[model samples]
Target: MAQVQVQEDPDREERITMEAIVDAYGSEEQAMGWYYYLDDKITFPFQAKCIQARKVSPLKLGEVVEVTAMAPADDCEREMFVLIRWVDRELAVPLVQLEGIDVDDETEEAIADWHYWMARGYELG
Candidate 1:
């Protein structure tokens, strides 16, 4: 029998993360009000209002989840929200819970900088 080897790209996870960010924020230019996930939580520069999903299920501690921003329906109260999706479950969280990263420079720069470190497997300490 012959053996076949499969190797995964080192930057695959980072690329996926960046893609999700782009999808949620609709381009780096419009990402000023967007947030990034770090340390198992979303953070922002200033204090702001946020909403949490009505239902929360038990989740693994270090699982990687994809997040997306969703616009509220016509009848909804808030203007925007986020959807956190994982293996087999999804949760809705208010935009306030997410903290904006780039308050000074343009969001594009922030995204590029973030992707640079993340692609190299950098983690916050």
Candidate 2:
């Protein structure tokens, strides 16, 4: 039998981490969109539908919620609805409603790194 050595790329690892983080919270259009903390109450650029803030898990403040999809609201003008995961109920929320919410430190860091990568012209896959 022959022995083989494997090498790793730190940059690639970082990119993979950033990609997973983005995929967990944001959409393809905005990978870092949901990167903020739940406590920050950050506002989204577009409105979401079916969101019930009261129904969010109180104990999962540090957890990340991904926006799976977005669609135009039927009853509103210039408003959109987004579907999020990790909640018990099917909730959509207006993007503006997310303002000022706090997020976990790891998520924040991942977002920052993702942004940095984007600024460097690294197209996120």
Candidate 3:
């Protein structure tokens, strides 16, 4: 992907506001356009939903997270709540990258609930 040059925000050093990001979003619809762009890039069993973070915290790998979603797949279009399991980072990794390899339906459902997997983390053995 080609890098786009952007001017830094005045108030925050490394962080940029949503308005600024929207401004850079081009002429696309402001509401749900971001999710559409992501949905095009990544194929999921269902559509992707844009989850606005109430609090921004770095996500951990190998952790199960429940993401409310819409269908991005060709066959499916109905909005549904989807849970995803994240994989841990490997030896050499970078910031903001989660090593998640999408799994089959059975495994995907099993991962949606983290509490059950906490004790069975070694069950794969």
lDDT leader? 2
Question: How many Å off is the CA of 48 in candidate 2?
Answer: 12
| Runs off by more than 4 Å, candidate 1 | 1-65, 71-76, 100-125
TM value for model 1: 0.26
- For TM-score, the strongest prediction is 1
Give model 2 RMSD, 1 decimal: 15.7
**64-117 per-residue lDDT for model 3 (tens digits):** 343323323321121111233334431211111222245454333322221122
CA displacement after TM-score superposition, residue 124 of candidate 2 (Å): 32
**Stretches of candidate 2 exceeding 4 Å from the true structure:** 1-63, 75-78, 98-125
Candidate 3: clashing pairs of residues: 46-71, 46-72, 47-70, 47-71, 47-72, 62-87
Candidate 1 RMSD computed on C-alpha atoms after optimal superposition onto the true structure: 16.2
The digit string of per-residue lDDT tens for model 1 on 12-36 reads: 4455356434444343322322333
Q: Sorted by TM-score, highest first, which candidate order results?
A: 1, 2, 3
Per-residue lDDT for 1-125 in model 2, tens only?
11222334477446645553444533333433323321123233322222234343232333345554442334112222345553575455443333213544443444344334333443423
Q: Assess candidate 3 and give its TM-score to the true structure.
A: 0.24
- CA lDDT of each prediction against the hidden true structure: 0.36, 0.37, 0.28
